[model samples]
Each structure stands twice: as structure tokens, then as C-alpha cells.
Target: MFVILVYDTAVERNPKVLKTCRKYLHWTQRSHFQGELSTAQYRALMAALDGVIDPEHDSIVAYTTRSPDLVESTTLGLPLGGPGEIL
Candidate 1:
């Protein structure tokens, strides 16, 4: 699957969350990441993020597509990537 993960974390734990996400996804923008992963990898990434974030103070949103072929995005200012590449 293709995943787009974004987060807003409490200041204290922000670095930990960023580091954990970098292991599984490419950091495409500030507080945003994108990549492809298997079901297991996605689950592991979520689990790892859960461990680093404070539920009451942090927010993580994941957008996913069944395959990279199904994903599409466009950037108006600076291009992030073309289709099939990480968004």
C-alpha cells in the first residue's frame, strides 16, 4: 500500500515521532511523510508512532491507497514528485 502520514506532536516527543517515521517512510515535507509499505509494515509503523505520541496532545493522520498506482497528487509551488513517486 501507499501511505501518506502526517503528524502534529507535542514539542517534547516530536523528535521521537519523526525519527520513528523516517525508518519506514520518506520525509516529504515538514511533519509529513510518504512511502509504500506492506500491511505488516504499515501496522508496525502505526504501532511505533503510537508508542511515541501522547494521545491527548498529539495527532497523527494516515492516508492510504491500495497501491502506488492508485495514488495521485499535485503541488503548486515546488513539486514534490511525479505520479508513482512518493508524494
Candidate 2:
């Protein structure tokens, strides 16, 4: 499965969220990440994020699809790297 994950969290929790996501996805922008994962990997990523995020305060969105062709991405300025590369 392919997943694009983005998040906003309390200032104090931002680092944790970023760290966790980077473990499984590419850090595409300030708060955006995308990568491919197996069902189990996806579940584990969510569970890890759950531990660091405040459900009441933090917001997370995961746009997932079984195939990359389901989405098109364009970069206006400089481009980031492949799925797991850091900015």
C-alpha cells in the first residue's frame, strides 16, 4: 500500500511525530510524508503515531491507496527525493 501522511501537533509533540513518521516514510515537506508499506507496516506506523499524538489536540491525515498511479504529484519548486529520503 502507498500512504501519504501529514500531521499537525502540539508544539511540544511535533518532534516526536516527525521522528516517528520518518521511520517509515519520506519527509516531503514541513509536515508531510509519503511511502509504501505493507498492511502490517501501516498499522504499526499508526500505532506508533498514536503513542505520540494528543487525539484531542493533534490532527493527522493519511491518504492511502493500493497503487501509486491512483495519485499524481507535482512539484513547483525544488523536488524532494524518493519515498524514504529526508529533505
Candidate 3:
């Protein structure tokens, strides 16, 4: 599976959230990540994040597809973080 994960959390919690996401996905930009993961990996990622975020104040979003080819992205300026643009 391919997953794109985005998160917004309090400043103090950023490190934990970012670390958790990086274990399973490629960081793409500020608060953004993407790449392939198995179903188990996906579930594990969520579980790890569950412990890091405050549900009432933080937001994490994940979009999944059967394959990476199913998604198309365009970056308009310099890449802000992560492994730079894939292309």
C-alpha cells in the first residue's frame, strides 16, 4: 500500500509525531509524509501515533491507495523538508 500522511500538532509535540511518522514513511515536507507501507505497517504507524497525539487538539490525516502510481503530486517551490521531491 502507498500512504500519504499529514499531521498538525502542538509545537511541543512535533518531535514525537515527526519521529513516529519517519519510522514508516518518507517525510515529504513540513508535516507531510508519503511512501509505501504494508497493511501491518500502516496499522502500526497509526498505533504509534495514537500515543503521541492529543485527539482534541491534534489532527492526523492519511490517504491510502493500492499503489504509489495511483497518486500524482506537484511541488511548486523549493522542497521544504524530507528527502526532497521524488522526481
Candidate 2 — worst ten consecutive residues by lDDT sum?
78-87
C-alpha lDDT of candidate 3 relative to the true structure:
0.88
Model 1 regions more than 4 Å off = 81-87
Poorly placed runs, candidate 3 (over 4 Å): 80-87
Best by TM-score: 3
Put down candidate 3 lDDT per residue, 63-86, tens digits, no spaces.
999998888888787754645532
User: In model 2, which regions exceed 4 Å deviation?
Assistant: 81-87
| Full-model lDDT for every candidate | 0.86, 0.87, 0.88
Weakest 10 consecutive residues of candidate 3 by summed lDDT: 78-87
- Residue pairs with backbone atoms closer than 3 Å in model 1 (clashes): none
Ranking by TM-score: 3, 2, 1
Higher-scoring candidate on TM-score, 1 or 2: 2
Per-residue lDDT tens digits for candidate 2, residues 20-57, read 99899977877888999999999999999998999999
